[model samples]
Target: MTNSISLLAEEQVPESYGWLAGGIGAVIVIALLVFWVASLISIIRSGYSVGVKILLAMAAFAYPFLGPLIWFLFARHKEHKTRMDR
Candidate 1:
């Protein structure tokens, strides 16, 4: 009887986690889709330069981790005065 009770307890724990994970996954996917659409629309309206447009579009709709990388690397203006220029 004790073994059966432990098994039931273990099963309930995983079922709860499964629901939580599924909810989080759904939210991420929805946000990604919404951002992707908004980015495309803004890109079209502004008619930004190809490079800038690409960067903005990518930043607007990417995995949460990707936006910062794009911002630091390509989205911001590059420093024209390099050490070699000095």
Candidate 2:
């Protein structure tokens, strides 16, 4: 009986920890995806290369906030100068 109780307790601890970790990881992945999509939309609105947009979107997955800033400063600025895209 004592062994069974201890085993149950041990199982519960790992399961709880697993749930917490999974929740946090899921949140991070979702945030990454949302930021990536937002970057894609911004690039699309400004009329950049489709391939370049895809690459820029992928970057948000790693550095969620930085991707758009870089795109705005570099890609969007150049797109304007080209003026053919917009």
CA lDDT, candidate 2, residue 35: 62
Model 2 C-alpha lDDT per residue in residues 1-86, reported as the tens digit of each score: 99999798677769659778778989998986776677778876766567766676687556667876687567777776655632
Q: What does candidate 1's lDDT look like per residue over 1-86, in tens digits?
A: 99999798777769759778779989998986665565466454553457766666666656444664444455343423321332
TM-score of each: 0.44, 0.47
Report the number of backbone clashes for model 1.
0
As a TM-score, model 1 comes out at 0.44
In candidate 2, residue 5 scores what lDDT? 100
Best by TM-score: 2
- Which pairs in model 1 have colliding backbones? none
